[model samples]
Target: MKPSHAIQGKTSEIKLLIESYGFVSPAIFGSTASGTDLDGSDLDILAIIPAGMRGKISLFDIQHLEAELEALTGVVVDFNVENSMPDHLRPPIEREKVML
Candidate 1:
């Protein structure tokens, strides 16, 4: 799919995944976040899973999330999962992920 379509589709899927995972934090950051630039970019989503969910998370689960999102939207979505983040650290990471 085209990058812009991928960005929009991935952003929507990320939001739904966050909700399904029961994240209460009002600010989940993805490609649509302020200061995030999507020109020639891949999807970068920063999600704060619930506090008690800290170390219990799995990379496989994240991979599955990405796969599910891709299947639903026909867009490849990537994510970075963190737990109990302080309000300040959220934006920068989502905006400036290294594409390597």
Candidate 2:
């Protein structure tokens, strides 16, 4: 399933999963957001950890959330931290992302 379509009707679940891991401003980008996803395409998701909570969240927590989201959406998930991403990649992704 397309990432957007796979997530349909699952907003509350997705939100809970995101919040449990201390992430906020969840959004979809790349092929999923651009409506260009093909079979086997991975879901590109951006989630932010608030400045105050940054160090409190662990790499394990992030991986756990990624696994959970992949299970929920039935797609490979490429989860990323918005703040930690390199500068050059931000513009196009920000322009295309669909906030959840």
Cα lDDT computed for each candidate against the true fold: 0.55, 0.88
Clash pairs, candidate 1, are none
What lDDT, from 0 to 1, does candidate 2 have? 0.88
Determine the C-alpha RMSD for candidate 2 after optimal superposition of all C-alphas. Answer: 1.1
TM-score against truth, every candidate:
0.54, 0.93
Q: Report model 2's TM-score to 2 decimal places.
A: 0.93
**Candidate 1 per-residue C-alpha lDDT over 50-83 given as tens digits, one digit per residue, 9 for 90 to 100:** 7677666677777777677666656455666556
Q: How does model 1 score by TM-score?
A: 0.54
Q: Write the per-residue lDDT of candidate 2 for residues 19-75, one digit (tens) a residue.
A: 778889998899989999987889998989998897999899889989999999998
Q: Say which candidate scores most in TM-score.
A: 2
